[model samples]
Target: MEIIRINERPQQVTPRGVKARAVLDVPYINIMNLTLAPGDEVPSHTTPVDVLFHIIEGEGSVTVGPETAKVSAGEIVVSPAGIPHALAANAGTHFSVLVIKTPNPKNMAKSG
Candidate 1:
């Protein structure tokens, strides 16, 4: 069995400029922990694989397709493939989420 410790991973800046720690990058899935400081954001973009964002701590605004909503810890947000989505930490709080990509795509390039 393999064990992954979230906090032990080095934080890296994503292409969108948000801070994230890659957890898994296997053929079946890709997972990362994304942390956003107050007012930080992940720019809107569409990917080829379905995405799932699970709020791990704090709260944030999530935009999927044409709809946007506020989500707090314990909530899960879905973003289907080919749809634009983004995330932002509330102005006064931090936000942390687990980003999961199922059936990991060969090309993770933004489609839009």
Candidate 2:
């Protein structure tokens, strides 16, 4: 058994410019904590694996495919693979989201 603490991980900038930390990285799933400053945006993008975004702090707008909605702490959003999804912090609000991707994309490709 392994244990991981989200706050103990050092945050790093992702290729998309969001501050994030990989709290759990394994073959079957990848878990990350993403922090967005006020007005910061994560441009729309598609993933090869399904993703679940759990809001942990503040408020934001989450766009999944053609749908967009205001989301806040305790809210969870799902984005299926190959669908465009994006997130943005409210005008003066920051956001912390827990991102989970299942079946690791790289492993999926290898198994295909």
Candidate 3:
């Protein structure tokens, strides 16, 4: 059995300045934890693959394509392939969520 300890992973700062940690990376899927401080946001951007956001803690807003919603822990949001998506932490609190990208975009590049 393989074990992945998310907290043990080194934190990486994305281009948008959000704190993140790569939790899982494989040929089929990629998963990462994103932590955003109050007022922090991951700007809207388009990706070539489907994305799933699983809320881990705190509250935040998620925008997938044209719709946006305030999501809290235990909620899951889906962003279809080739669409724009973004995330923002609510004021006065921190937000953490798991970002899962299916089919692993890196592998998609290698095969496409």
Candidate 3 Cα RMSD after full superposition onto the native fold (Å): 0.7
Ranked by TM-score, top first:
3, 2, 1
Model 2 misplaced stretches (Cα beyond 4 Å)? none
Clashes of 2: 0
In order, the Cα lDDT scores of the candidates are 0.91, 0.93, 0.95
Query: Which digits, one per residue and each the tens of the lDDT, describe model 3 over residues 14-54?
Result: 88899999999999999999999998999999888899999
- Looking at candidate 1, what is the lDDT of residue 12? 89
Per-residue lDDT of 54 in model 3: 99
Indicate whether candidate 1 or candidate 2 has the larger lDDT: 2
Note the clash tally of each candidate: 0, 0, 0
Measured with C-alpha atoms, the lDDT of residue 20 in candidate 3 is 96
Give per-model TM-scores.
0.91, 0.93, 0.97
Best by TM-score: 3
Sorting all predicted structures by lDDT, with the top scorer first, yields 3, 2, 1
Alpha-carbon RMSD of each model: 2.9, 1.2, 0.7
> How far off is residue 76 in model 3, in Å?
0.4
Write candidate 1's Cα lDDT for 5-81 as tens digits. 99999998987888999999887799999999999999898888899999999988999999999999999999998
Score candidate 3 by lDDT.
0.95
